[model samples]
Target: MSLGAFFLICAMPLLSGCAGFGGNEAPPPRPIVTAPPIAVQPPPAAQQPTGVARDPSKFFTPAQMAGRPLIRVAILLPFNSPRADIRSLSNALYNAAQLALFEFNNPDILLMPKATGSAMLAQKAAQDAIREGADLILGPLFAEEVGAIAPIAHASNVPVVAFSSDTKVAGNGVYLLSFPPDEDVNRIVDFAVLRSMTKFAALYPQDDYGNRVRASFEKAVADHGSQIVTSASYPPNTEGMNLPVQRVASYGGRHGALLAKRSELKKAGDAAGLKAIENSDTLGDLGYQAIFVPEGGTRLRALAPLLPYYDVDPRKVKFLGTGLWDDPSLAREPALEGGWFPAPPPEAHAQFVERYRRVYGAEPPRIASLAYDGVSLAVALSAHAEGERFTTEALTHPDGFAGVDGIFRFLPDGRTERGLAVLEMHPTGAIVIDPAPVSFGVPPAL
Candidate 1:
């Protein structure tokens, strides 16, 4: 498909069905020219259906008025969920969206913040939105929640920009405004290849998240004309990481080689050579030149030091990681001091954080920036479109958008493509070694 067409995946064939919720109990969304409003919860999850989408106007049916017409944008999230941790993240995102709306100060749009306590609630909320005459939809944070909202929104022909990262829930008229690991790995691998680090390896965790990361990493490596010399997985815990580390270092094979070298030196009675061999570490070259650790936070902190201890020293093998490495606390970890990872340019996000803190009176979560970007994109599109906005063509603009992170746009496959940078972990802090792309571009495929 063409680049522009590739972005409007919803325009192609209709293949999606999303569930939803509706109720007067939802937080009423006010207009931005009057912006409206966080909360926390935990994580757990996980599906969806397929069908042709219906015309949006058939259900939206908002009557035309003077000046800029007021459009209703639904903001579905689990504001009152059971998990406080998840609630915090979702609330931060909601606040970020509110911040964007406040900044936009666009009197033309009325944002509706609906508390989607569950899939059933989300489904009802969406159905209620259809009845209320919504022109657009902003989110339903979780994948299943997005599914609940989809069928109602699509059948009504209303366009949705869901915050869920699960690509499986994307399709029909729904667009995912999430940073999936697939894009993260693809961008990092591209950066790795550009650094001339061809040989690759991955130390993965034994979990579904790790599975996705592994698949993305493999495809990215292959696409860049590189190969994974070693790939191994370990349990989620800190202990027993040895097997994966040893496999990557080729510990058994190298030990055998070391013994053979020692035998040769001993047989020849070369005292100086024997001494040098004894003092030197294991075989320096383990084939792969770079190793990717698809982990982050304390788990990553625990896993990184093991590489060198297991003989895969930074001096020999370059350590790589995903965007998960973009954490302030990580700078304190000496083991990750020389590692590299992919993320959006930090300076832009720093500006966002400062503004968010000032407005919200507290620091927002890292992922919350996405909500700001998503809402900002909505505002940008709806500002002067005269209701023509939110269409596939308008939503999938080729220029993409300049958000808190960087440039990003939608794809025909119902996925988001973001321009990311290659960051280097240092003792001081993580710095952008490579800036995100200034323009939109497709990621290379395997």
Candidate 2:
């Protein structure tokens, strides 16, 4: 199975670091969203960066290193895996990091190749990266690998910036860099609530990814004081899809009997009756103005029509989805029309895109830029601090950093507070019909 498909079945358990924050009641009072300063744009082309400015903490702060010493960064990835896509993604991320380093006087970042397609190989690679004197460890990519390496990294006190979102496996110095599935639902729920979507219905896969998304969506809905009229889970397959779609779409308390009613229709009348029944089973009403779908785009395409089938007009009901909905195929899917989700919109990184293409001979993928930002930001912190300890003070500085992606600053919990744009998949194969209001400040300190 593809890594994306497999991630659905086996996901790493998340470790919650509540930081003694209060109960899940209302999220603490949020700062007003305002227009970011125009300087939020990319760095000026003419402004010659001092080496210290390249990574401020690395030089400026008493705790971080200065002058771009050979930053021995070790990239840990599942390179030997059968899934070439993830391998390619890893390569892209590595290339992006390298490019970032080159801009900062080309530090001595190394890729510690591992034979991690199998369980045994992953262990060997994890040990090897540490042995090689890695200052900052990039990844072991998968959740299982992260779990295996967490203790080792903790023991070594080598800061690991990971690609996996499974926070449970992330050790003290390990910072998860992958977009959390819960954050996806949170953004959608927040947007829907802003637009006044009071009732919600969800149909998701019967797996961990789906479960994580469902839990987040449920919590968001409840937190917003909205009701979830119907929520169901189905196996991530075609046959498993139609039933739930029919159930959630069915009108007037006749959710489970669509198939039975179809059987009762005479052969001559069945064709016409099936059409009518399908239509009846598909449409939702005014009260159900939002649908949260956490499944991947392929399955959602098949299920999308069922939204209209139940009477939920795609135009009327605000469709919410996960970060996986960023797939380009979503544009071609008729059911995804009017859908919105939170993601690092590529348009925001125009300069990064051009530069990456110039360097890598291809457009940078989502995670590639993210990994680049992680390394670049780390270097920035290292430069700013002018020491090797990498204190928390170095990380949360508000000098307003810029990278291949847009401006972002670090939060206390090691999560990046980035400005995410809410993009819509238009019928014309375009996205980002309406952008969310950008928050200029650091995201509530995590």
Which numbered prediction scores highest in lDDT against the true structure? 1
Candidate 1 lowest-lDDT run of ten = 12-21
The candidate that achieves the highest TM-score relative to the unseen native structure: 1
Every model's Cα RMSD, please?
Answer: 9.1, 15.4
Q: How does model 1 score by TM-score? A: 0.82
Query: Which residue ranges in model 2 land beyond 4 Å of their true spot?
Result: 1-68, 107-115, 118-120, 251-286, 385-389, 396-402, 407-417, 433-446
Summarize candidate 2's per-residue lDDT along 102-199 as a digit string, tens digits: 54442433323333544445555555555655556777678887766666666665667777776566546666666777666777788788887889
Model 1 lDDT, residue 180, Cα: 80
Instruction: Evaluate all candidate structures by whole-model CA lDDT and list the values in order.
Output: 0.74, 0.60
By summed lDDT, the worst window of 10 consecutive residues in model 2 runs over 10-19
